[model samples]
Target: MTRVMNAYYSNLIEGHNTRPRDIEAALAGRLDEVEDRPLAEEAAAHVRVQAWIDETSSRGDLPEPTSVAFICDLHRRFYDAMPEELRFTEHDGQRKEIIPGAFRAAGEEVSVGRHLPPSASRIPAFIDHFALRYRGLTSGPTGRILSIPAAHHRLNYIHPFLDGNGRVSRLMSHAMCQAAGIGGHGLWSISRGLARGLRDPAEYKEHMDAADQPRRGDRDGRGNLSLSTLTSFTGWFLTVMLDQIRFTEAMFDLNALQERYTRLIADLYPGKQRLPQLVAHVLRHGEMARGDARFVTGASERSARSDLGELISGGFLKSATPKGALRVAFPLDYRERLFPNLFTDAAPIVPAPPPPPPL
Candidate 1:
């Protein structure tokens, strides 16, 4: 669920507003059902990249998040999965191909708004320095946690990729937080906070732009960039992260979850007194023997089977086989009701249409 939200908000921040419904469809191999195929493809690619990061991290085989090689891999994995039409960027009326895992060529010069990135030829050296400096800053967990925002900003400053630099930097920051032991196990997402901008989305971009300013005088840090401005950006970034953490924490609290879960069961299965307990059991235990539903609900086998079938058809429960263990399921159509405020789209959620026949 957080992965879907992350993909939605991250793509939204990049000006591609792929909704959670579309992302969910894409993940379920129903791409043909999604209305905006390109955007759905991008959202799907983002989720896949994050999944790779999580799996690699779990296996302890992840490359250093700050390393250029790891950064390029993030960009490569994301764009490589993108549709052909989305893999190119246009500048000054000219179109250029974005090499998935490669930095901009020597002659490819570019500017972002008012800030001119270093010439493409110099990106390699800048990236090397970036990795080294950050390695030193992140030698300890304390340093690692504190350096997240700075590293995020500095990576964007380097602008290593022809495009997709923003996405790559956000992914790197997420990995950094995970390595630092502050990732909340994917329970919370920084991209949501960054995209929300605490109120206006421009606030995020404004801070990034401010941090790009040159040294503001002797009082600023010794670097060519302004330390005071970077410090300000860091403070804002940390505040946003803390806010997201608190929001997710509150949403998942035991009492809060129980209340919401109860409400959802009641609303979805109104007047069905037995479903709440049965569903709650599956929710708590992860899965339950299908035959045991009769015992859990205090109903006869026939009635219990009927009740379970209803929940399964409603997308509230799932099973791999006719007699398989029943597991809790939160279908996209019911996500907003089950987890309010998780999505900002308030327009009535038309239940997702059925998928088209396979080609």
Candidate 2:
């Protein structure tokens, strides 16, 4: 559920409205004829890459978060799965193709909002400095968490890729959290917080743009950018991350989750008293063998099989194989009942508008 939610919000930030139900359908091998198929495919790609990042993090094999290879690999994996038509950016009536995993070519000049990224010829130097500065940080976990926002902004400021910079930067932030052991077992997402913060699109852009300004004065640190604004943005980002962690933790509280499941079972299968027990067993054990359902629910084997079938059909339980163990599954259709306020019906947030030309 968290992975799907992350993909939805990440795409939402890019102005793609691939709803959660549509994402779920795509994952289930049901493509939509009315909606653009490429968009759905892109969302699935985000989920796939995120899963890879999670696995890599778990194995402690993830590359340094700020490494050029890590950033480029993220771009490559995402666009590799996307349609060719969606892989280019146009500016000044000229189209520039985005080559997967390649840095922008020399002579390329890209502008993000009001700030211009350093010249393409200089990207390698900037990235080298970025990696050296960040990869060597000796901060503890709390300090590392606090450093994510500045690191995120700096990567965007560098703008290494020709396209998909935003998604790649966000993915890097997630990987950093995992590397620092702050990802909370993937229970929370910063993209959701960012998407929600951008609910007022202007404010979101304003905050991001604020960090792009050059050093305000001598006391603003010696870097080329404004350390104060960077610090402020970091605070905002961390607050959003902390809030999401708290919200997810509260939502997953054992008592509350049990109550929510009980109500859900009653609504989906009225008067099926043993269904909740089966759900509880799966939740407690992470997964349950098919034959163990009868023991857990105290129902006859035939009745247990019938109840399990209903649960699987309703999208509440998922089994790897037809007759294998069953684990909990949360379909987006029932997300509101099971996980309330997750997907809001609020207006879409637009991306940051281009900054006005300098005076």
Candidate 3:
């Protein structure tokens, strides 16, 4: 679910606000039900790329986040999963084909908003310099953490890819945080904060653009870009990250989370008195056996099975094999109630869809 939120917000930052239900359908291979097929595809692509990053990072096979290979691969993997028509981008009134994993070709330079990226010919040199500088940051957690925003802004400032630079840069930042061991194990997302936390997405772009300005006199540091603005952007970026962490932390606090689940379960299954205890058991032990349902609910064996079946059919729980251990499952309709304030379009509490009629 957090992964879906990350993907949704990342795409939202890029101005592709695919509905959460559509993204859920896309993940479930039900794109036929999605109205905005292209947007759903894009959101699914973003999720797939992040899954790849997490899997690769866990295996310790992920390349340096700043390395050109890793960065370009992030671009490649994302676009590779997108629909063909979405791979082409228009520039200067001419349609240009975007090659997966390839940098902008010479003479194919493009402008992003008010900023023009470096000439294609200089991309290799700029990328090499970028990789070298950030890879060798001071060996400590603080240095690693501080490098995140600096690298995020500078990578966008470079704009290596013609069309997907924003997404690529964001992915790179996520990779850097994970590499630094500060990514909260995918429990929270900075993209959510960046896209909506400030109440306006433009503020994020403004900060990035502010840091893009030329050096301000001498006290601003010797670099061509203004170090002060970069520092300001870094501060804002860190604040957003910290805010997300705190928000997620607060939501997940044991007592608070239990209360939320209790409320949600009651609302989802009104008057099913013992359902919450069964859910609590699953929450604590990760899964529960069919035989234990009666023990936990203290219901007659038949009634216990009926309750468990209702929870499963209602999408509150799932099992693999016939009579397998039951694990918790979060259906889309429950999201708003289960994780309030996490989404802007928090729907009013609604009962889970009724079970399919008897065949």
Any runs in candidate 3 off by more than 4 Å, and if so which? 345-359
What are the runs in model 2 whose C-alpha is more than 4 Å off? 198-202, 345-359
Show model 1 residue runs off by greater than 4 Å. 320-322, 345-359
User: Can you write out model 1's per-residue Cα lDDT over 1-359, one digit (the tens) per residue?
Assistant: 88888988999888998878888888888987898988998989989998888777777786889998899999999999998889988965789889998998988888988889999999999999999999899999889888999999999998988999999998998888888888877777789889977667788899999999999899999989999888889888887887777777766665565566767888877898888787788888889998899989889999999989888888888988887898888877777766666767444222332222222
Q: How do the residues 23-63 of candidate 2 rate in per-residue lDDT, one tens digit apiece?
A: 76666668754276777777878887888899888887978
Which pairs, if any, clash in model 2?
Answer: none
Where is model 1 poorest over a 10-residue stretch in terms of lDDT?
A: 350-359
Residue 136, model 3: Cα distance from true site in angstroms: 0.2
Give per-residue CA lDDT, model 3, range 1-359, as digits (tens): 77788888998888888888898799889989998998998888888888888877788776789888899999999999988779998977898889989998888887877888899999999999998898888257888898999999989988888789888988888888788887776677678878864445687988888888899899997989999889888888887777777777766666666677778888878898888888878877889999899999789999999989888888888999878999988778877667776676464232332222222
Question: All candidates: CA RMSD in angstroms?
Answer: 7.6, 5.3, 7.9
What is the Cα root-mean-square deviation between model 1 and the actual structure? Answer: 7.6
On a 0 to 1 TM-score scale, where does candidate 1 land against the true structure? 0.92
Worst 10 residues of 3 by lDDT: 350-359
Candidate 3 C-alpha error for residue 104, in Å = 0.6
